[model samples]
Target chain A: MTDIAGSATRVADIQAAYLAQARSKRVMNLILIVIFAALLIAGFRTADRRNAGGFWDGLPNILDFPADVIGEAIERAHLLPGYLIKYLPSLIETINIAGASTLLGAMAGLVMSLLVTRGLGPVPWLVGPLRRVLDILRAVPEIVIALVLIFMLGGGPVPAMIAIALHTTGALGKLFSEVNENASLRPVEGLASVGATWTQRMLLGVVPQVAPNYLSYALLRFEINIRASAILGFVGAGGIGYDLRNTMSWGAGKFDEAAAIFLLLFLSIVAVDQMSSILRHRLTHGAKPGEIHR
Target chain B: MSAQALHQQTRRNFNRKRLMSFALPGLVLGYFAYIFMAFDMAGLGVRVNLENARTLVSDAYSYKTHVTQDNRTGAVEIAIEGERKGAYAPGTAPGWVRLGETSEIDLGGGHVVTFGGRVTYDVPGYGLVMAEPGAGGVNASLPDGALPDFISLSKNRLMVKTDAGRLTVTRNRAEVFKYSLGWELFFFTLDSPYHGMSPGALFKAAVNGEAGAIWQGFVGNKMWRHGDVGWALLETVLMAFLGTCGAAIIALPLGFLAARNFTPLGGLRFAARRMFDFLRGVDGLIWTIVLSRAFGPGPLTGSLAILLTDTGSFGKMFSEALENVDARQVEGITATGARPLQRYRFGVIVQITPVLLSQVLYYLESNTRSATIIGAITGGGIGLLLTQAINTQKDWEEVSYYIVLIILMVMLMDSVSGWLRRKLIKGNGGGH
Candidate 1:
């Protein structure tokens, strides 16, 4: 009985030693993790201080100016009634900018895409340079381009359309090229073998395969363009961004109305998102391997 | 037999037509270039540089351009192409140009006679160039030493390189950059005695301008007394660097958690995964507005904006990385009766560090541009300086310098990230 007890104690000692070593290893890992976390925390603190002015400077105004400036306006304009009347109309106008820009941009994109693919067929040394030009157009954002147009057009929707269209062309051209590359090579090659023209091949063999995806992408871009249009208004390009900026600047602290606008925009975006998925799924049904029979 | 020959001839004609098919691309590019230059001139700062040679007049010059024209001749007022380009063109008139106190005569047919501090002619539109001020000489014969930063003497035509791309300058008319810069890194931008302008042309107008025959172009600027360009530069770099670091901190854990394959199916993990997509769905600038509102406006806003946006972006990416890992290792751990967490820690996490590091580095590099835009909006960093430059729209030479610095910074960041990506992720396509 004593021998049996001694053996049990020895086994217990070995188990405890192994457990302690394991615990120490975990503790070391935890220490390293803490150090990393501390470093990140420090970074955030520094970043916050650097940006403190952005949040704090408007505070005294956010609180006091809302009462001083906006309170009078609210009383003077008859408050709730005036805002309620103008809000939906203003929102619609903002929506209009997105609609117009997206339409114009999509059309331009379609044409530019054809040009990018050399659907008309490779022409000259200058054609190679066209790719370069497209690169430049794609590199700068649309709003930046719009700023220039605004100067030329004098604060209107024309510049906004131009900017959106130029960007859409670039983006679509890229997508188009990718589509062209992925199109049914056999059909296109078969057309080519018969000495069919570049235009013929593109029209018959290429466009069909990717048209659905292209449409879906264009719709997606339109949704994005809507939001972008709203923002560009801040720079005086024309849209709700202008209104948002003015209201905020004038201390129109009716965050409820603002919140409503945001909510509407969010819903629009979500609807667009769901639509895109549905459309894309329909277009590429069973695109995943083994999902459907060829 | 003649009929057969005729049929062969027709087939040959069709092939030739195929080659000619690309001619439209040239027309398209030509039209695009024209529109770009025109918009830049109308006080929209959009420009495009082609390898520091000639301004493609796209992204290097004008900084930005927006115009709506239908086919045929798209009439847009271009700022033209030079630091002093639109100095002759007036400022801030709706339809008319200022045309400054300078005069340019378009000799109609690819020749422009320019008069300011110097008299010179640029060849009509690139492919060949010459500026003749001295008696009886082509651009090549213009007294030995007047060439821009990158002039190609090898070609029969004189090509002046600007924006890191050479162009046969002034084959048409003298245009200008409506911006200005002081003697800030002037020598670096130039390749020593570049710009075929005699010292008289470059320096004669400056307050302490001095002119010599061959290198007389040494002029000191007095108009742009330094206000706030230097500190702004440091802030710009810091904004980009800190923005990237902050983003990485947010991205790493979320990336792991959001990874589709690694995370166990539960409400908590599922919510985290969905959060990644939702965050990434919105644009970076949009986030800037929200965070700037919440965190206050500054580089911090820009940085946080980037952090939030990139967390979503990287989470989606890391999830894919986790999915792509070799499953054999996980199987080995599981066979030993390791817990799911242990299997993940030893099997997946250890393998994907390199991928995470490399992707984070790339995102950091990309965020530099985002940082600039955010800074521009939030009123912080060099973008504030850039915004101020745009607001004034008169000192394009300075804008040019700022643009050059920004581009250089971008290049530096790209190279650094590429190096880091390569170092971390060996024998693989480093985080596309």
Candidate 2:
């Protein structure tokens, strides 16, 4: 009977401890939620105040610009094809900028990745400095370089291409190095034992293993670069975006052209996005067992 | 399969791989050749401005002080960057300049310029070049021999360019530019009381209870605008914070509706998925343009643009996460007779919070960069200041300052978000 009573007291003590712990956890969660909510509200208020137009006042008019563009396109439906054809060259230029930059950046990134990866690199001391170089390249927004280059090189596709390519180099270098870290070192070691140079080893051994992943990442970067190229164009780097800005600046009467350009841009972006996604999916997952490989 | 057939297949694969290895690079090369022509590479040499490049690079690290003598008034004044705000008092000048009726500027390295009755530039290798400005236009005299390439002489104006300094004399004004190696008025403007105070002196002053006054001057500096820069940085971070958290909050429920496992209604799921695609397809640039129309340019527009674009991304990722969640937990909760809401809260949200939090945090870091770019377009944040400074085309030092701050800001955010992700993910793992 005494042993049963002692066991009962122990059970009671365990329940009290659990309940107290749960209550404190609940209080802590509540405090965090309250603080988060307060921050959100305060941030919104500050943003609204700083904005040129208040949020509530501007909220209702959000659809006005889109509506105007759509309405103008509908009215000038016949001229839409002409506008599209007229701007196709610029669109192609934008796409070309993206493609060229992606290609160049990926090649540079591949080499840099090999140089920065531990055990795979020829010179071990280069890793830290190269990593910091990549960091700086990634940190600088394309606009900064593009604008500066535009001042020197004048408004054109080259400045935008170089700027975007430099950024892509940094971004892809870091990502590729991370992929390299997970890659098998056996192939590199085997090639090294055979007196193969760093370049030969990396190209012959490592590249084959990581090519699919690199291609997938490069494809994703291409999609991003297309958008970046368009933006750079808006800032006077020569492309469809420059035309868009011109049409938009003309306002009211020329919105039809703007709408057509918008349609072209939107459609092309979606097309590339879809294509890249499918390709990336295939690259990452591979084909079915019975299917022939690319 | 026979050994002969298998061997043939292997041989064919090798041949195809070898063909691909050559053809792929060839294709890329062909494309680049085309781009070279399309982007006008051949003509780029003629279009390129080496002078502008030199100015941009040089001005980025150095500043020039101007010693001017107004031809009309015959009054001399010294100023940094020739800005009225950076001008010294009538009786005051930098240590390198001796103030008098005839001010003498030591440009260093045996190069000197005297702004007095007649502007005289003393070059080390070249002889003294003198120019007097009056109503009849610049009356100039150079060395007896042929004029050097550095000097550009015209009827109304005379200009001399040297490594250490440059001199320009016109009918209206005569000015000498003395290049220096550091940014001027960076810490404190000419108007500030502590304009040239050393750190030790500043510390001593602070101890003497003048700290607040000194800080006020530094923060309120018209040239550097330290206070404004601090606020701009905060705004940029706020944009990333508001956008990421707001998207996460808005995407959670939409994610549930879109998830195959959570929602039985096929039509609702399809609609939600399509919405996500449409939002993501629109692109942040277009969204920035559209939002800026209604909201005008500011942090609000930038944040909203980020929010709208990220909402689709987060929704799609979240739904994918939700679909992959284990059903066993939900079944266990249902066994306890839990309501649908309670089942989701205890079962689904708990499991996916780590994934969702990590994705959101990662985006928070990237969005800081996006915010900066958007801010440039929308006319807000440090990006706006940078663009404005660049447009002016003379304030390269200011541009460099903003660039450094932007880089530091991005790196800081990157590290902070990374740390938070590691902490939260590990915390969740341990709790389970």
Instruction: Point to the candidate with the largest lDDT.
Output: 2
Task: Compare the candidates by DockQ and give the number of the best one.
Answer: 2
Error of 1 at A155 (Å): 1.8
Candidate 1: stretches off by over 4 Å: A1-85, A88-121, A124-128, A193-195, A216-220, A285-294, B1-245, B255-266, B270-287, B293-296, B313-329, B336-342, B350-366, B396-432
Docking level for model 2? medium
Q: How large is the C-alpha RMSD of every model relative to the true structure?
A: 16.4, 3.0
lDDT (Cα, tens digit) per residue for candidate 2, span B1-432: 999999999999999999999999999999999999999999999999999999999998999999888878888888899999899988888999987777888999999888877888899888899888887778899889987899999989999999999899999898889899988888899989898889999999999999999999999988778999988988888898999899999999999999999899999999999998888888888898899999999999988999998898899889988897889999999999999999988988889888788789888888888888888888788778888989999999988899999999999998999998888788666223
DockQ (C-alpha) of model 2?
0.49
For model 1 the interface RMSD, in Å, equals 9.4
* Pairs clashing within candidate 2: none
Query: What is the C-alpha DockQ of each candidate?
Result: 0.12, 0.49
